[model samples]
Target: MKIISEKCKKCLVCIDACPVKAISKKGEEVTINGDICLECGCCASSCPNNAIEYE
Candidate 1:
């Protein structure tokens, strides 16, 4: 599974890249709901800042 790190810039790109819609934004913070995530790696691949990582 992957998680968003402190390096995130709130671009919200990962949210859109996630095929399972597991990535979410609450205020300025973006998060990935592991239970709903498909672990397809799309969010990590689309993250321009390399904020998403395997944990």
Candidate 2:
């Protein structure tokens, strides 16, 4: 999973949707701790701004 460009609006939609609560905000950006991420793709689907990308 990766964050797209610089379009993240810090909406926190991805953070709330994450079942493991793996998404975290630092400054104006959000990041997912890979170790805690379950690769469930829930965050990607939930992001309204299409900021999260899973591969």
The candidate maximizing TM-score is 2
Per-residue lDDT of 6 in model 1: 76
Judge candidate 2 at residue 4 and give its lDDT. Answer: 76
On lDDT, the leading prediction is 2
Candidate 1 lDDT score relative to the true structure: 0.83
Error of 1 at 24 (Å): 0.7
Residue 34, candidate 1: alpha-carbon lDDT = 84
Q: Each prediction's Cα lDDT score?
A: 0.83, 0.88
Q: Model 1 clash pairs?
A: none
Could you tell me which 10 consecutive residues in candidate 2 have the lowest summed lDDT? 1-10
Q: For candidate 1, lDDT tens digit of each residue in 1-55?
A: 5554578988899888988889899777888898998788888889999888887
